[model samples]
Target: MNRRFPFDIARQEFGRASRGNVAVIFALAALPLLVGVGVAIDYAKSANVRTHLQSTLDAAVLAGARESSPSAQIAKAQSFFDAQRPEQFSAKTSASFSVADHVLNGTAQAEVPTSIMAMFGRETLDVSAKAAAASSSGGKVCILLVDQSRSQTLLANSGAKLIAPDCEIHVRTNVSPGAIINAGVNLDVKRTCVKASTVINNGGSVGNLEKSCDAISDPYAGKMPSVSIPGASCKSENYNPDVSTVVLPAGNYCNVNFSNQTSVTLNPGMYGGMNFNQARTVKLNPGLYIVKGGNWNVNSGMTFTGTGVTIYYADNSIIQFNGNVNVQLSAPTSGSYDDILFYEAPGLSQSNWVINGTSSSTLRGLIYLPSKAVTINSVSNVSADKATMVFASLILNNTNWTITPGNKAMASSSGGAVRLLY
Candidate 1:
């Protein structure tokens, strides 16, 4: 059976069918495009927040590791994180700090808020950072200057040559060019670490120079013994002996003056002021010599020798060696002041310690003056074979000075350093 329809009626039916198919195809394609755009925007927001979180955490951990106190470290970490966090996102920051066996460890964590990613049900991003620091325990330090002010805390000039091959020199000056070697001066050492704002080298050679180093704290600050002046002087007035050889016993003296061709031998004891002027020979026995509220002066031609001894200076005291002199000193091998040749009292007035001589000198111990400046000028040969440590506020070398390391074991066993771990 053949059933025919009108042309207008068939055209209308085809047009309606095509319109429905076109609508369905357009709806299917538009959905995926919208989804892709939304995902990209949400992921970009997450990535931005994650980057900020990681940077803040890293800074927080570093701050925490620098603090020596355990309680303070945690507090510092939190504060640093809060300060470094970006204001665009709300982040919950937390950190932990711990120290064991001189090693400091820090960990920081942050939960950063997400913005456009909320559509995907991801509302937060986790970021973390860790840091570690250590206080070094081994290594010999030949020189340490602990002054925070002063552009030239350590200076070598006038053709001075300092050779320290087995140790490091640490300078803690906050001024520009904290340590310098002037023209015609040569400094040869294993390492020179400075905490100065700037470093300057004029015409000298230094091996392994490190600028902006960490400050070194005193290791024996609290361990020094207290000293009290005697109520009544055991011996008073000046002692100018006419004889060639004289032996002085240990006691409390008001003022000790030796001059004019006198050969003096000092027994182990306390002295108020020991002054030697134009003396031929001076000897010190094995013990401690405490000088209080006076000046220890050795001028002109003098020969000095002391073995197994330690010299302690009280407040407002000065030690000077002028003119040509021969000195050989060694610290005690055992006791409280073991391996300590010279020690200055804490909280004393800031002054200058001068050591100048024309002849060779041998010192085998530590010379510690935490609050004073030490100047060494025009010495021929200075040898510290049994380990020697010079710790002062400032150290200046003028003219020629030669330093040789004889023994590394003479350095203090308690000596160590603190540093941040990157």
Candidate 2:
């Protein structure tokens, strides 16, 4: 030790001291950076837990809102929440619900624990969410499809436009290859929903789509007028339309054809479905017109008009109306089938029903075809005071339909919508 010089000893001591100071300075600087990183990681984990709770809370709120009683609602909400609890962060959650003014309101809170932020004394983060829902009326399904297993239940072909400001367009086929809202078709309505999970919108302006919805059952099923076909003795014989005017009584008939510019009037009763090839003018008075087995077709050269009428297709073959002239029709009010214009029998053959009319047509009321593929073609628009079309399937080809909802019964409600507040 005594062999070393005094300058050498001093240099060795300075080097050791400098190294110790540098390490101290580095530890001090890295502490803040480590804490910042830990906060970010823990905050992201808490946010992910909150997101999971939010989606689960939405489902719980909807389940509670659909219940009838307050106790039942709470039970349903609790059951659904338990069944669909998010398995994120082992969170502790609590939910509460209340119904006021026909609206179901829900609030939920979660204690989502942080992982890395625990070192900085942040043990848990508080998260909250809210939701509201209500029920709608039963008579608001306007353009509805009944099949729930078909590949393609409804299609809006090229050049098809539908503007229904207050109507409900519900397609209920839940199978794959579902409804196609193709290109060149414009659909603007109040509410448009498809039950299928595979709804394709190809460059067309369809509804703000909410797919995979619950299928809606037909409202008018098992609820229609009783059918009683008239006997041959009480039936009207063959109608020969070589005259200028003919007033038809309420009776049954078979294979009647109207031609030769004949003017006709119809009273309400059972009758065989007929064809209108060429007619000057045809009027249907106010009552129920039961149509038995036969076809109801109107060619291009027919001028037909009806108001305050209900045509019940008991067992008709087909209903195709080609419109080149004036064709006006409506449904009855203050009756059993108040808003029903054409009611196809549920037991009828699964055929096709084509309904097209002129732009001056006043075709209104509910056209219920539960066992038929309904088509609307060659028409420009369907402006009506009140109309509801329920089909097995629907097709629109090169036409436009302006479905106006003048009936308060056909108006939409807030039940179909569930909203999250915060």
Candidate 3:
């Protein structure tokens, strides 16, 4: 019974049977594509949040490092982070600030909320940033000029030779030609760095001169020991003895003037002004000499000797040595002003100081004047044994200066710079 079935009925049967299988295959293939698109959206959102959090943390840590106190540092970090973070997102932040071995370290972490990834049981993205800053204390600085207005802060005139083999010279002027060396001037140092862009060397020899360098801050400003003047017990004296040799005790002298071929020995104490003219020899005992509101002048043919001593100047005081003076001075080995020979008061206006040392001059300490300019003029054959000089400005005119490492180490008075290290 070979009976022929209807063609239309067979075709309809086949179409009905394959419709369910085709739908099943299409659904199976589309599931992976949907999942992949969902994952991409979630990951992209997380990455954006993480980047923002990281940048915010970095800024917060850098701002925090400027604080000296640990508690203040943490507070500052939190404040900065709050200011920089996005308002649309919520985040949990944790920060820590510490100082170890003179280094300031700041660390911050942020946990940001995730929107798309939350569907997959991931709710947050973790981000962190760390920073470190420190001040430097090593390296000897031969010359430090703090004047920011002058185009030529350090000038080497004709026949001048300034030599410092183991140290650097820092100039803070931002004008053109922060340092200028004229004809026949020779400036030879280990390094000469200026904050300005231009340095003028006119027919002179300069060694390792670099422009646009970092500017250093005043290290001893407001950090020096204060000077106290006695009230009722103060005494006034003018010592011009006829005798060849005279010894003075340590006390409060209002005005002191010594001259006329006399040899004077000064005990360590406080004085108003010490004026010496045409003296044969003057000696300073090993202690502190605090001078206030006066000019310390050694004029014309005087031989001065001081060891283990420090001279403190305050209130519109000046130090001037003229006409071929022989000086030998060294700083104290142990004290509040250790390795410091000369110190000036802070918050004072600019004053003039001229140091003219002869061939026999030997200064073995630090000379620090935070708010004044120092000029070394026509000085020859002077030797600095572990000596460092810091001032608001400097001028070297027709002099030959040499420095060598001696009994004490020549360290920077200004603490090193603070910079972000991540």
Candidate 4:
């Protein structure tokens, strides 16, 4: 589910055209919504409460559905509704949310003080909106390719298998040789959609595929983390502690170069260019980590226990890991970035994320990298437990790995596409 890099000459020649393709795809996808909205202007011929109420309700339910916990879902929905509901109806509009069987249902009610219908003896028009959203039930995209110009954006080498039958694999590139499946590669996915064609080498097999489909647009294009955290500044130098055992506080730390035999406890906050050079045991507290720029490299004999965390990778950052390391990291269960582990902030620069950890490493979350290519070359079996959604520019698999990216059907992005299923 990944590939080789495109040549610099190719990038220069086709970069503009590729971008144009994305615009066209976006316009086409938005056309239906635009039309639907235009038809809504009449809004029962009143141009009143119901129309805006419906849109806001839809958004609230969708936001709620993205979270895993019931309380978090309801809280997020109410927050969005309160913040975005029309000001004119702020005092009159109210909404409630509930979750059942993984589906988030919401209802909004508003009383429009009739501006024109008052003469008809009706002082107020009672209106309501209902919406439902499911975060998981299959059919959601697990692996997404955002680059449209490069050939081999998705390449599955020999013995590689994409073990995601519960999700869809989308190839957005329409260029020839868009995707290649080498010998012994088996795409074990629900469906594989390609804009152009998939070249199959000897003994390559693709199950449930659709060719010549419209490119699936990036759902997390503009919803990246901020380049810098609010009220926080960059650290000036490297973190070299005097003692072998340390408990780093929740603040900005620069140049995270770890040495051998150091037992360190890192409280959640901002870190710069984390590198694990020697054997060290690192424990991460539950919180958010805003890591700005540089190589997040991990090497030899390191044990890490980090559950309930989110790593927001900003700027031109890359992830490199080696075998012989044991690490377990789980994503946060609540908040705006819930269910997401690695969130790559949008940038002009393109990068690569290489995960080459050993069998003992367990990571649970959506590795959301919208502007990078990722390669999973784990020598031994590692589980993507609880959640394992991989959103990238492209993905490569060189081993037989079973990736069940959870059962939740929501997009990795909070602003991702959501329909009003009444």
Model 2 lDDT per residue over 1-422, tens place: 56889999999999999999999999999999988888888778778877888788788877765553344556777788788877687888887777654455777788888867777688998888777655543224567788776877888888989877656687878786568878898888766778888888788788656678654556567766665656654443444555667788876666676665478888887666577767778889988887776777777766778888988887746656777756688887766777678887667767788777555566787777788887877776457556777778988887767776534222232344544433
lDDT of each: 0.68, 0.72, 0.72, 0.67
Off by over 4 Å in 4: 1-137, 224-227, 230-243, 386-392, 407-422
Record all residue pairs in model 2 with backbone atoms less than 3 Å apart, i.e. clashing.
Answer: none
Clash count per candidate? 2, 0, 1, 7
lDDT of 4 by residue, 1-422 (tens): 66546786688769888899999999999988875664454334334567888899898888776653456678889999999886463328888888664467898888766533454466566778899986433354667776787777778877676566766677778776777777878888776777777544467777666667554566455654454574546554444545577677888876666666388788877777777666488788998877765666678677777888888776666556787677788887777767778787666466776767455667787777766777767445566564545344554556655556553333333224445568
Tens digits of per-residue lDDT for model 3 on 61-158? 65665543334456776788777774336667666666543345666676767665677797877766666654243244566788888788888788
**Candidate 2 regions off by >4 Å?**
1-139, 232-242, 406-422
Task: Give lDDT: candidate 4, residue 402.
Answer: 55
Model 1 weakest lDDT span, ten residues long: 406-415
Candidate 3 — worst ten consecutive residues by lDDT sum?
407-416
Q: Residue 390 error for model 1, in Å?
A: 4.4
